[model samples]
Target: MAKLLVVGAGFAGAVHARELANAGHQVDVIDKRDHIAGNCFDYVHDCGVRIHRYGPHLFHTSNDRVVGWLSQFTGWLPYEHQVVALLDDGRKVPLPVNLDTINAVFGTRLETADDAMSYLASVALPRSPVISAEDHLYSTIGKELTDLFFRPYTKKMWQLDLSEMDAAVVRRLQIRTDRDPRYFRSDTFQALPTDGYTRAFERILDHDRISVRLTTSFSQDDMAGYDACFNSMPIDEFYEFDLGELPYRSIRFHVSHHLAATAEGLATINYTDAGPYTRETWWHALPGHRVHETSNVLRTIEEPCCYRENSLERYYPIKDRDLMYQSLYERYAARAATDDQMFFIGRCGTYQYLDMHQVINQSLVHVSKWIARS
Candidate 1:
C-alpha cells in the first residue's frame, strides 16, 4: 500500500483519506482550521442554536451513487428548499423569478405562461453575440426588475458591477416563464443528513489507518513520508502562490437570535436592491426536522472585501478574462502533476466551484483512477 497525505479535512480530502486508508494505504489528513468539514462546517452557536459556521450547505445531488455512498454515513432528512426575494414595497416573491413573482411584482396579470414568455421575448434585446450580466438584464428584463433584483445582488456577491461580468452568470439564474419555485432540477427532492454533515465526516475519518490532524499545516519537508499527497486546499496557497495569487470573494454572517416559534417566513431571503448583504438563510426552515423554539436566526452577508489577503481562505474564485485565473491555476496544476505522485483535488485544489456531493463524487472517481494506475 502507498503512503498518502491528504490536505484539508473537507469532504474532498476526508473522502480521499478514508478511501485510501480503507484500501490499506497509510494516510495522513491535515487541515489548517481546527475542524474536519470545511465551509460545510456546522456547530451550536453561542445561543445554543445549530448554526452553519460558514453557510447553509443543503446536500442535494441526483447522482444515485453519491446518495448511496453518503447513506452509509448518516440517515437522510427530507427537505424542500424555498427562497423568496424581499421587495421595497413590502412584497415577498418567490426566487428564480417565477410566474408568481412576475405577476405579483408587476401587478399586471399575464393570462398564461405563454403570455409571460411572449412579453419577455418581446422586450428582449435583439440578437447579440454576447453581453454582461448588466447588459442581459437591462436589455431584456427592463430597468425595474434588473435594478430591484439582479444589480445589487451581483455587486454584493462579487463586489463588482453586473456589467463587469459575463451575461451567462445572470442568465443562469433568471427565468421569465411560468414555473414552480424549485430553482434547480437536481433539488426536486433535497436531502440533509439527520445527524448533521460534520458527524458523517468524523465517522469517516475515524479509521485507524487514517490519522487526522486538525489546526495543523502541512510542510513540503513532510513530503518524504508519503508516496502520494492529495492537496484539497487552495491551489495558490499550497504552493505559496509562486505564480501570483488568484482573486476570490468572501462572506460575512450577520447572525442574531430572538425567542421565536418560526422564522421570518423564508428559507432564504434575498435583499437584492442594495445592502452589505444579498441573501439570508435559516437552516431550520427545512421540512421533516425538529427546530428549537429558543434557537436564533442565522443570517449571512456577503462581504466582497474579505478576500484581499493572499491566505484569507478563498471561497469563491474570481472568474474573468482579465483576471487570468486559469493561467495562474495552470501553473499550480502543472506543478502538482509533475511532482511525482502528488494529486490535486476539490474546488480549491482544481480551482473550480463544486458542491459537497460533487466533491465526494470527484474523490470516488479519483480513487478508481488511482487503483487502475496501481
Candidate 2:
C-alpha cells in the first residue's frame, strides 16, 4: 500500500485520509490545531451547550452524495438555520430581505410574493454592467435596504467598501419574496451532526490504515517519506509568498458565558450598525447543542480583521471586483501544478470561499481522480 500524507485534518484532509485509507493506502493526517474538524470544531461548554470554537457553522447542502457519504460517519439533527438583522431602530427583521422584512422596514401590508417582487422592482435601479457588490445590491434590493442592512455589515466583515468587493460575495445572499426565514432556502438538506463536529471527525479518521497527528505543523521538508501528499495549507505559504501575499480576512472571537437561558432571541444576530463587532451567535440556540442542564449559556461575538491580526489564521479569502487577488491566486496555482507528487486541496490551498459541503465534495472528487490514475 502507498503511504499518503493528508494535511490540515479539516473536511478536505479528513475526507482524503478516510477515502485513501479505505482504498488500501496507509494515510497519515496532520493538523496544526490541537483538535480536528478545522473551523467546524465544537466542544461542550461548562454549561452543557456545544460552542463552535471558530464560529457557527451550519451544514446545508443540496448534494445527496455528500449527505450519504457523511451519514456513514455521523447521524444528523435536522436544523434549518435562521438569522435576523438587528436594525439601528432596535427592529429585528428576517435576513435575505424576505416579504416580512420588507413590510417591517417599509410599513407595507403586502400579502403575496408578487406584491413584494413588484415593490422591489419599482425601487430597484437597474445597472447595465453589475460588477461590484454595491452595484449588485443596489440593482436587486435598491439603495435604502442595501444601505440599511448590508453596507455597514459588509464594511465591518470584509473591511472593504461594497464597491470594492466582487459581486459574487453579495450574490450568495438571496432576495426572496416568500417569508422563508431559513438561511439556506435553496439547499435540499440542512442539519447539524447528532453528536458534534468533533465526534464526526473522530469517526471519519478512525480506520486501521489511517493515523492522525494533531498540533503538527506542515512543511515542504516533511514531504520526504510520503509517496503522495494532499495539502490544505495556504498556497502562498506553501510557496513562501515568492509571488507576493494573497489577502485573507480572519475573525477575532470574543466568547463569554452568561447566566441566562438565551443570549440572543435567535441563534444568530447580524449587527447592521457601524460597530466594531459584525455578528453574535448564541450556542444554546442551535438544535441538539444544549447537552447540559444548566441555565448558563455561551455567546460568541465576532470581529473581522486581517488574517495577520489573528496570528495568520486565514478564514475568508478576499476577492475584489477587479479580480486582482484571483489573478495572484492563479499564479500560485500554476506553480503548485509543477509538483506532481503534491496536490493543494482546501479553501486556503485553492484560495476560494467554499462551504463545508463544497470542501468535502472537492476532496472526494480529487481523491477519486487520483485513485483512478494510480
Evaluate all candidate structures by whole-model CA lDDT and list the values in order.
0.76, 0.91
Candidate 2 lDDT (Cα, whole model)?
Answer: 0.91
What is the per-residue lDDT of model 2 for residues 20-113, given as tens digits with 9 covering 90 to 100?
9999999999999999999989999878899999999999999999999999999999999999999888989999789999999999998999
Which runs in model 2 stand beyond 4 Å of their true positions? 127-131, 166-168
lDDT winner among the candidates? Answer: 2
For residues 1-374, write the lDDT of model 1, one tens digit per residue. Answer: 88889999998998888888878888989898998888888775555456677777888878888888878888888776767898888778988887888788778688788888877666556436557777777677767677777788877777778878888777766574766787554454477777787888888888989998889887888778778888887778878887898777777666766544656646677776676777777655654333454545554544454566424767788888465887889877888788767788988889888888788999999987786777
**Stretch of 10 with least lDDT, candidate 2:** 257-266
Candidate 1 Cα lDDT to native: 0.76
Each candidate: RMSD: 2.2, 1.5
TM-score of 2: 0.96
* Residue pairs in clash, model 2: none
